[model samples]
Target: MSAHNFLGNLQTYTDGLVEEGKTPAVSVAVWKDGQLHLAASGILNVETGVEATTDSIFQIGSITKIMTVSIIMQLVDEGKIDIDMPVRTYLRDFAIADAEASETITVRQLINHTNGMSGDFFPDESRQSGNQIARYLDRINRLPLIHPVGEYYSYSNAAFAVAGRLIEVVTGVSWYNAIEERIYQPLGMSHAISHPMDVIRYRAAIGHFADQTHPEGWKQTEQLYLSMGQAAAGATLTMRAEDLITFGRAHLEGGITQTGERWLSKTSLAQMQVQQVNVPTVSKAFTKGYGLGWGLLHHKQPEDTVYGHGGVTYGQLSMLRVIPKQNICFAILINCSEMGMMTEITNRFLNELASLDYSEAQAKFVNLSSVEQKRFLGTYASLGDGFRIVSEEDHLVAYYEDTVLKTPVERYSLGALEDDFFYGFNRDGSVALELQFKDCQKDGRYSYLFSGGHLRKRVLE
Candidate 1:
């Protein structure tokens, strides 16, 4: 399909999703080569009934991590910091459950999420305490590490918290201000911002948690506090999808801003994209890993490596994907509770962009006998997600751990389409659930259960 027609179809689909009560608002943008296309649907704020526009801002969750870490790369370019240097060389107070491991943790390890620390920990800080990078690190000793200092791949939000502090200490300014002075202003990202209050000045989109069955399907949610420690999160960077794509474009072009200013040298920019650690696959379309703050994705077919990131703020979710070789990038921001919808949109769009047909390659049905299926039945978990696979009369029902389940939780009855691929009803939404099993041991032990590009490492069985 032509790019124009593809965007048209995307616009129609997005509008239908919102009008059909699937989401309150959605902002989508596609940047291919030098041209960019944007589309929006539904209201930015259902309570006020503000229609979303090309300029409407939505929080780009962990997508802010790339921004925060990019500044760190700038520091690297200036010789203010070295990626390989141990983090303790700058922050002496940094500590974890393992003293030896703590001393060995490097800036590279933290950025790539190989530091072995449990990445969970979001403490809300009042705006007045914005200068809090040091205070956050002082208490890091209380938290425990999941593995050793540089064992393997696991997502770490806490690592970015410490990274924010590193930025503050080296630059002689708050990490938040450093971001604005170094990133937003330099790149001319006028709509990009880190403060929640600053969002009020614009046509802000209020995140909504919708229960369609409730008397009123939507409930407005308060903006989350972006603590100083979480500067990496952009504390919820509210901005237009196209501008976000521009940011990604800068990285793709070896750190050159649109206005002809060179932000970082080609060497440093390449360092950011090079794969640092092999991470769990999140979807069948791409083999994902961590590279600095950006996600390093290896497309299964084209096998092209792309850098992108996904962000979440309460019920709001945003995603950005960029392929430098093709000069193509896309961003999707939605204010809703159904995150699976984001993947549904992204996967189809990606497949269409590549002119690849998933159905053609869909694995043929292969049913494992009841006795053989036992190996697939178990609980798998990562930091913030998990699922339990149980056999129900020869069929496998995956009880996903979700707070919004109709009962205690939702169960996805999966049927085999390929030897290791399965599809089923993905909630009440239009999207169907597709799952792939990978890295299984010869003895039938699987290490990661990937869906939506978020790898939930096997915690049991």
Candidate 2:
């Protein structure tokens, strides 16, 4: 359970994957009481033969939402901004594809993704200044909506960019300075920067696409386009695993800076953890609902709650989870876009530390009732893709192109209802399926909606 042993286990898991040619590089850190536990595996710079280091910076991507959410909450505490007030009330230029929804959208809704905004249309220059971001607000009129504001969960980075611009309008300071003074510097996250354009010369990892023929390989993305939406997610900050641990500790300690600065009141931090909108549509890799800037996960057994955020870009993936009740927080950064790999490694690392057996948890889905078993026996299809799902006795599975089905048909319990659809939980008891079934069809399909424009579909075969 010690930090050293925990990190050693992580190194083994990530290194094993690296040797198998799965991940190029991965960095991990754990924090408790302002202390850091660090570990690294694989190469930081493959060409230079540089081993991954604690300070090796990788794009944290949408994890920048955390800094945005924290600063907004601080403003709320100071009465400079009201969470319920419409976003346009403060920034007159704010507009949405749907005029009515735009008029009603509030600051809290924007941060929690309850705003109707979808997709990234903020003309890459918006991340620079308030005026630049405001100029892009006119484009929202052409965007489309998946659902009405506050009605259903739909992730949108564009919404965050607009939120960031609103922050500048209210604070009269650059979004970068607000985050640095309020969140990063206060938390001692020195290496974390808002713009990748500034850090290109530093020791940072370039993202690579496994499909080399594709245009998104590491070499191609070395010069990613800068955006005015940087506040929403343009920050290409990198940090030592230890520094990230310090960042996690701030949330674990309820918004208290590592040096004892109470950046936001406990009540405001609590609001950040409240499940304002259900994200049942997001992937199993995500959780049940979204708080202000974090994902809300509910754990059974010992009965605990976790609040954190995750980010993914072209070639990197990052996750930060905080079990406040356990006084444990961990962050994982991988220089590969292996879906769920970071989550898998983080879970395995936590298992070793908690000394909790997962056998029972893993085995929970083995047995299936005749009725439950029969329901999965019919043909199923994904909504977006034409792929079909068929049941093989007790196992439900699917296949698309050359990818094969590894494991399917496990025991799952229904979680709460979100917009009339039920989400499923796996043996580890985390929400895994966001599904809805028709009695006539007898076969159900599942879709995971992770932030805006990111959707995954699967048929239960």
Candidate 3:
């Protein structure tokens, strides 16, 4: 199909999806075979009745992590930092609650999420004055390791915040300013902004929450951003979908900008895209493994190699995907927290444009005896949330509680896929969760539950 016809069809499909109330708004940018296509649909804000356009800016969430790691890699290229070296080598004062782990954690561990520190250490304050990334250390110092250092893959937002601080120390500039100077300007991404205040200069999209009580079945989110201090972990960065793919295009071209200017060495770019650690089997729906900052999709197939990142903050969710061998890049930004909608859109785009299918790969269900299920039944909890597994008639059910968000509890039915691995189905029978039990105790009960990128310990009564 011609690029013109493809874009027109995409625009129509996006419009129909939004009109069906899947989400409030969405903007997409696709670059394939040296051609760029852009499409957008729905209102930026229902309250304001502003229509979304290709230029509309939406929070890119954790996709900001790629920008953060790009800067870190630049430092690597300049010989100012080493990925394998201990993080404390550069940040002398760096210390977490586990002093031993803090001293031994490497720069590579932080970027790949093997540092094992608690992932969701958001400070109470918002937009604090003076080096917010640096000030994050005072709070992170108290966090205990959720897993042994470099032994497990537990996503850590705090680790990346520490990395952001390392950038400030090495460059003598705020993390925000460093990215703007090194990434945004050089890549010609004029539509990007790291601060919320600057969002006024563009047609910015406000996040939306699904509210059945509202007449429109959705309402604008009360909070627009997550904690500002964790900007390195994808808190406050907003940009147009076009600008996002621009950055991805640079990486797709092996770290060279459109004008043939080298932003990072080919070596560093390759390092960032290579698999650093394997993720849980459930995570393979989106990525099989993780690279330095990029999530490795189709890592085993070199000819079809693709790497990208997804971001979430407040009510917004965003995704960026790149197929290096095809010289293709695409970005999707939405103002509502709708994972299913995003997944469908991603699968459709990839199937049509790249001849690739991205459907979730589900494991076959294996029935477990009551004796087998008994060992896994219990409450497993993290700092802010937990899951209580109870045996139902034929399968196990997990009651999920969100302590931090104070949202209503959700329930999922668990079907054993193996001795310790299980896939969870929502009430609607959708396969939305995958979890594993690890670290069995002498008493025959498991000691930890790995789900949702967190390792939650078994809570005793």
TM-score of each: 0.84, 0.75, 0.95
* Candidate 1 residue lDDT tens string, 1-461: 76557866877877887877878888998887577878898888767889998788888888988888888999998999988999999887888778987789999998888887766555656655535667778767866666556866667778888998888888998776887899889888888877655888777677778766644488777644445566665455788897898888898777889999899889888788888887643245556677788887676544466678888776688899887777788899988756767877776667666443333343356787898787777887654456788898888778777431112466787776654767656556333566666677988867766565444566753
Candidate 3 has what TM-score? 0.95
What TM value does model 2 have? 0.75
Which of the two, 1 or 2, has more TM-score? 1
lDDT by residue (tens digit), candidate 2, 388-447: 334445444332221111113345454334332444556676655445433224243233
Tell me how far candidate 3 lies from the true structure as C-alpha RMSD in angstroms.
2.0
The worst-scoring run of ten residues by lDDT in candidate 2 lies at 399-408
Which scores higher on TM-score, 2 or 3?
Answer: 3
- Angstrom error at residue 358, model 1: 5.9
**What is each predicted model's overall lDDT from 0 to 1?**
0.75, 0.62, 0.85
The collision pairs in model 3 are 62-311
Models, CA RMSD each: 3.9, 7.2, 2.0
The runs of at least 3 residues in candidate 1 whose Cα sits more than 4 Å from the true structure, single-residue gaps closed, are 8-13, 124-132, 214-216, 222-228, 282-285, 300-303, 351-360, 364-408, 413-461
